[model samples]
Target: MLLVLSDEHKEHLAFLPEVDSAVVGEFGRIAVEFLRKGSTPKIYEGAARKLNVSADTVQHGVEGLMYLLSESSKLMISEVDFQDSVLVLGFPEDLNRLLLQLYLDHRKEIRQILSELAPSLPHYHNLEWRLDVMLASRALRHQVKPTVSLKLHLESGGDHIARVLQTDPATLLHLIQELERALAEAKTNHCRRILRNIK
Candidate 1:
């Protein structure tokens, strides 16, 4: 059964075992607020002051929250920095299909962009493309999703340009179109060569 917590319930998530109720509530509150602002929350003294809890209590709350989130196999959390005390929590890779459709819709433009951009690097020769998809959640089974990334590597170069994520798809499409016309011309020349040698 999916547990849908209203904002109020999220604020009062007191079921976390072995931690003070106040600490659990404060941590949940902070997490919801950070999610609202679309960024990760850093646990520190300032956050403790805002939550009206001690820095140590805030630290405990952060740990409790991590534990609670970690219990679910579908959810994953990665500690980005121990010194900075920042944690990123989100869905598992297989179920994270938010940008799948966007990339698939723009696949042609994406390929054109990579083919154009990689050759500009020094000592460039040829390029390769790989596309993969994450299986959708049961609710979104009807939708087609592609991984929201492009991996580019030059034949003669080391790891220069590794991966490119989403950035202004519309603008990238325009730029991709510019060089694709040249690629089309190249294909035509190849066709001419084959025709001349056929007989």
Candidate 2:
């Protein structure tokens, strides 16, 4: 199913120009736009509106798009079935891999995200936003079931410690805090012991 297009999705679709593959290109663009939006359009109506092509032309284009998607759909460990003459999918658990591939289809940002940030801040420059993949994965894990969400609890000091340790932010923050607390408690104990001896 294709949903309405967002500005970002449209901008993404607009780049699919092919010298000798206009229909394939447009089909790719429209199909991807549908994927990002999470809905499949009524092919003739939607493609006609967008491309100013005849409904029959758009139908031919969509057949190509559906063929490509159906082909990839076969490669996945997941399965789709037809019930009441409608197509459906099984194994939703692994769909993340598909989405991740599509998400990386925009690699222009990866240069800024993975390469540039890995040097300057080494963790995330201003915040953990540097590892959006990490963030997104954390969010996904929590969404899978009920447990203490590392992403949520580490929201504060975790990001700072990740910057300093350049490793797992949450673990480093805990160690840092434990060391600080030990120092503070040690000072207090020393003072209390000295006062007791003098008394």
Candidate 3:
């Protein structure tokens, strides 16, 4: 059952995680005002140094609150990846296919969040473009829904992508130190062949 939060609910949600207790207090206050005044409540992200919190801590805490609200709304849920950096929730089973908004609308923050979930990083602009076009096309130009697709789709002219795929950029430059050892082996191989020819 969806229970509508009121100004009276502020003191209750205060008991949530203390990632930014004071900022949460402010959110409660704004939530109450908006509940009573019918105004849009402002979202607050607290400072890192002031809270002695890393950005991932802040991002994860915010995502926690978002999931809480999603649970309240009874949204279908699934984790998008290993780091749990991206979450996508929707109800395709309903046929009407309701997709509730479970997001913070910042592109840069999404990019930064993805950068921490290492092994690799991906382009955030491409991510945004995919989603925007999905929303724009859904049940309008097309009835097909977006399922998470990660592998780069290949085209005929993909030489640059092929080269980059050969080595991860983060490790590419770091592998240079190993080249000298390979060169030493090659030099020894050449000297051994020359000695055989002279003999």
Candidate 4:
């Protein structure tokens, strides 16, 4: 998979060329540390002082590297693909190689950290629904009203949460149609390609 870098991220990483290769290595380390532990202002300040650059520049550089590494790791791109992704940044050959090496060395650890940090959200377990029809009410001798009741069961961390919803039959039908449309759209080639790159 080829990772696409946004303009803002490209700009953030622009300062890397001016910095020393050793410093760039340090930035990679800082990026990993930032992922493992949250941001540390003091580390940024020290790096800034050592590099003789503003803390914001150092921060942006580290963040840009973090974004690059995390996205590449998230997609689990191969070494050659990662090198190609960084090549588009217009960095020198050595720098590109260095970035690829950094990613290769730390991809596993970064993936682990990311997995641990991911939010544990509820997922669909089961669904139950009922349809009720009212006919021949006292006020309207020939009236008919249809209602749909839905019970959605979601499982989160081994616990089940049930949500009850009630809606008119027409609205429920519309909702189902919309959901089906969305599912169909998700199956399209464009969406499948995008989803593949995202993974």
lDDT of each: 0.43, 0.41, 0.37, 0.91
What overall lDDT, based on C-alpha atoms, would model 4 receive against the true structure?
Answer: 0.91
Clashing residue pairs in candidate 4 (N, C-alpha, C atoms within 3 angstroms):
none
lDDT of 4 by residue, 109-175 (tens): 9999999999999999999999888755688766578888999999998999999999998887898
Q: Write the per-residue lDDT of candidate 1 for residues 84-120, one digit (tens) a residue.
A: 1211223233222311222233334434433544464
Q: Which stretches of candidate 3 lie over 4 Å from their true place?
A: 1-16, 19-21, 26-46, 75-199
C-alpha TM-scores of all predictions: 0.21, 0.23, 0.21, 0.79
Identify the superior model by lDDT, candidate 3 or candidate 4.
4
RMSD of every candidate to native, in Å, equals 24.9, 22.9, 25.1, 3.0
Among the numbered candidates, top TM-score falls to 4
- TM-score, prediction 4: 0.79
- Model 1, global lDDT: 0.43
Residue 176, candidate 4: alpha-carbon lDDT: 89
| lDDT digits (tens) for residues 1-199 of candidate 2 | 2222334433332322321244544565555555444444476587578766566655544443443343334322122311111112221333323433433342233233334333333243343222323335544646432222233112232443332223355565687899999778868978779766543
Pairs that collide in candidate 1 are 100-146
lDDT: which candidate is best?
4
Which 10-residue span in candidate 2 carries the lowest summed lDDT? 82-91
Least well predicted 10-residue stretch by lDDT in candidate 1 = 80-89
Pick the winner on TM-score between candidates 1 and 4: 4
Candidate 3: how many backbone clashes? 0
